[model samples]
Target chain A: MIFYVVIFSILALLLVASGLYAIIQKDLLYAVISTGVISLILSVMFYLLQAPDVALTEAAIGVALTTVIFVITIRNTTRFEDENDNNKVK
Target chain B: MFGDYQNVVTMSVYGSSIALILIGLYGVLIKKHLMKIVIGLSVVDSGVNLMFVAVGYIKGGTAPIFSPSVIDSKPLMVDPVPQALVLTAIVIGFAVTAVALSLVIRLFKHHNTARIDQIKSLKW
Candidate 1:
């Protein structure tokens, strides 16, 4: 019981911290990475709760594929507005 | 922290996850950037996944597998339904992420920017 409680609380804290970082982050790439971390932690928490199936799915879909797609889009877009404007002049 | 031992902890964890979901929703509603919106969507997804996992935890539960040493012994086993549901949710989340990112990429390719304010085609 104690162990479960500790694990649950730790996972909850990680979720909150990662969510906050993702929301507050200015760089699009950074926000995407933070979101991936949130998903990865969620999968581990699922395993601890006796849900290996959910963990596997979350790891494969949320961590790997979603992060990849976001990185691809970010690579083709501007991270900051000011930098984009400077490129427009040249 | 309540009447029951495991139930109390499980409920607390689930409640916290719900709170995180709400925060993520707020981020989605308030953020103007397209990438931030995607981040909020992911945050919301994680919060929901946590709730699913918490629902499956059982106190002193053993693995669901049947062993030879316990022919007569009955052990507590955690629920498996929530885990399955969470797995489905994860797959759906990825599909949504893929589509959203693709839209973002196409939008950037045409407009040379990802900012919501810069895109005026749909706006009057």
Candidate 2:
């Protein structure tokens, strides 16, 4: 019982840490990758929570498809988020 | 309170999922880049999906499957309904993300920028 609690606690902390990392990341590509990490950890947690089906779906879609589409979009647009324009004088 | 060992596990799952949702909400609400907004939305989806499964999970529960080996352990199987629902949610989330990204691409093309504030002030 305590073992399960320990594992859950660690995974939970990791999830929140990665989430914060995703939000604060300056590089769009890195932010997307962090989101993928979130998905990866989530899939593991799903399996631990006794939902293998959901875990597999998350692994396939969240970890793979979502990140791919976002990467492709970033490739077409901008890799780094440009925040310099908000302060420019008109 | 973390007095009980079981509560720790349950609280961990619930707390983390909620934290993820909040972090994503912050990203969506405060971020200027269109890509960041999309990322935030997807994170929120993940958080919700996790919460769904967590809500359905039972302590020491087995996978909700029917097998001859476990003919008598039916009562220990985890709830399957939330799993099915989360499956659908995950797929729909993927579709939504694809559509959102495509829209971001279009916005970038039309406005030549991905910043939300800039896109807002400029002619589309």
Candidate 3:
């Protein structure tokens, strides 16, 4: 009903906002965190959509495992995305 | 009230998922950093998964689970096939992500840089 509509719209907007943040953020760590946030919201949406299996899998993998790997990769490399020298060459 | 209420609500899922996919594509094609490219790929995977699950939603449907209380609602259950397929897709996406990130790490270590433009030894 009204409740479903309200929640769905909000979740949908949040998903997009976080997705954009992950794409455009300057810091690699923040971008990684935003990706995790996107996954968390997606899991909830899966549950609301009556797919508990998907919700469970997403919660475990997307929120936890994927974020962990991304962070580890960032930790081993540069945290901030350096744009000056790289873009100048192209 | 909105005309055709269910469709309107579900429309948000479709629209946003498509937007996410486009945003991911932008990151992949435009970003110079290796990590950003990988993140974009992951976002694209999520968008696809979301769209698939959203497509399976049925009006007035219940979760496709078994119990003594809901035996009469078999036809009213949301599509379980997509749920199963998406489950496998999620796991496979994780594996693909792990492999891609590992490759990124290898490339970074070899070149001492994570920016894609700087790695030119492999370029033809």
Candidate 4:
């Protein structure tokens, strides 16, 4: 019981922290990777919560497919946030 | 100790899901980059799925699957409906993401930029 609580707390903390990092990180690649980390942690959390099916789906779609697609998109475009000219009228 | 742990488990699970949803909302609302917005949408999708699963959980319950080897005189199983619904939601979310990325690609090709503010050709 105590063990479960400890593990859950740690995973939850990591999940939230990684989520914040994913949103705030300047580099788009790092942000995408952090989102993948969140998905990975989320799958583990699903497993702990006794939802193996959801966990499996999350791992496959969220972690693998999403990251791959994002990376491909990044490769085709810019990888960092352009702070100065982001809102300039063109 | 056991009782306290149980409460913590339930509260933390639901609370974390809510926190994720709110954080995702912030990203979607505040971020300007197209890819970041898409990532935020994905995060929001995950949070909603997590909440659905967490809500369907039953304390001290096992998976809904029935296996002869694990038979018990009395069985407690988590709700299966939310799990099924979430499966569909996850797939739909994936489809939505693919389409969104394709649109992003198209936009980048047209404007040579991924920032939403700069792509104003359609703006009235």
lDDT values, one for every candidate: 0.75, 0.87, 0.90, 0.86
Candidate 1: C-alpha RMSD to true structure equals 3.5
lDDT of 1 by residue, B4-79 (tens): 4566566557766897799789888988777778778878878887876776777566545568876578677778
Give candidate 3 misplaced runs (Cα > 4 Å). Answer: A83-90, B1-4, B72-75
User: TM-score of every model?
Assistant: 0.83, 0.92, 0.92, 0.92
Q: Predicted chain A of model 2: TM-score relative to the true chain A? A: 0.88
Model 4 residue runs over 4 Å out of place are: A83-90, B70-74
Can you rank all candidates by lDDT, best first?
Answer: 3, 2, 4, 1
Pairs in steric clash, model 4: none
lDDT of 3 at B103: 92
Candidate 1 residue-wise lDDT at B21: 92
Candidate 2 per-residue lDDT over residues A1-90, each given as its tens digit: 667778899999999999999989887788889999999999999989988888898999889988899899988988887656333522
lDDT of 3 at B56: 97
Q: Residue by residue across B16-86, what tens digits does model 2's lDDT show?
A: 99999999999999998888898899889989998999899876678988788778755577889999999
Q: Extract clashing residue pairs from model 2.
A: none
Evaluate candidate 4 and give its CAPRI docking class based on DockQ: medium
Least well predicted 10-residue stretch by lDDT in candidate 4 chain A: A81-90
lDDT of 1 by residue, A1-90 (tens): 466677767777777787788888776677788888887887787677666777788888888888888888877777743445535535
* Candidate 1 vs 2: which has more DockQ: 2
By summed lDDT, the worst window of 10 consecutive residues in model 3 chain B runs over B1-10
Task: Output the lDDT of residue A88, model 4.
Answer: 58
Off by over 4 Å in 1: A81-90, B1-8, B67-74
Model 4 reproduces a share of the real contacts of: 0.63
lDDT for A39 in candidate 4 is: 89
The DockQ values of the predictions, listed in order, are: 0.55, 0.63, 0.63, 0.63
